[model samples]
Target: GIKGQSLPDHYEIDSSKAKKDLGITFIPLKKTMEDLIVQLADLQTMLEQS
Candidate 1:
């Protein structure tokens, strides 16, 4: 029971393997975060202009 320990090693998820094994294509975290930030900024700008 290791608490607060993320995967101890930097393991790159093999996309092909993921699709074959898990049937899911993982989205990179950085890209997801960037998209969220951009959406939030756009929403804030719209709110301010309204």
Candidate 2:
């Protein structure tokens, strides 16, 4: 799992409009997970090299 600042206890998104209008894009979970794994691997490799 990843950790970082979270949203406010009371948060909401107006789904009435298209997400793009709100400046948000839809990314599939599998793609996101794969990208995150690659990023972590790259970071780890850089750390080990240094």
Candidate 3:
């Protein structure tokens, strides 16, 4: 939301090599949901304050 031109309608990431390079596995579903809920709550709080 900076006072400038906007981004293009497309984007890309070369994450196909992430697993091989980082040695990481899938995220646990429960933890992922918890984190998302926390983030959404934080955003909602900020919106209300603003």
Worst 10 residues of 2 by lDDT: 15-24
CA-only RMSD, every prediction:
5.1, 9.8, 9.6
Q: In model 1, where is the ten-residue run with the lowest total lDDT?
A: 5-14
Model 3 misplaced regions, further than 4 Å: 1-22
Error of 2 at 4 (Å): 30
| Global lDDT of model 3 | 0.88
**Given candidate 1, what's the lDDT at residue 50?**
100
TM-score per prediction, in order, is 0.55, 0.55, 0.53
Badly placed stretches (over 4 Å) of model 2 are 1-16, 20-24
Candidate 2 lands at a TM-score of 0.55
Instruction: Give the per-residue Cα lDDT of candidate 3 at 27.
Output: 88
What does candidate 1's lDDT look like per residue over 1-50, in tens digits? 48886775666655797698889877899999999999999999999999
Superposed by TM-score, candidate 1 places the C-alpha of residue 44 at a distance from the truth, in angstroms, of 0.3
True lDDT of residue 3, candidate 3: 79
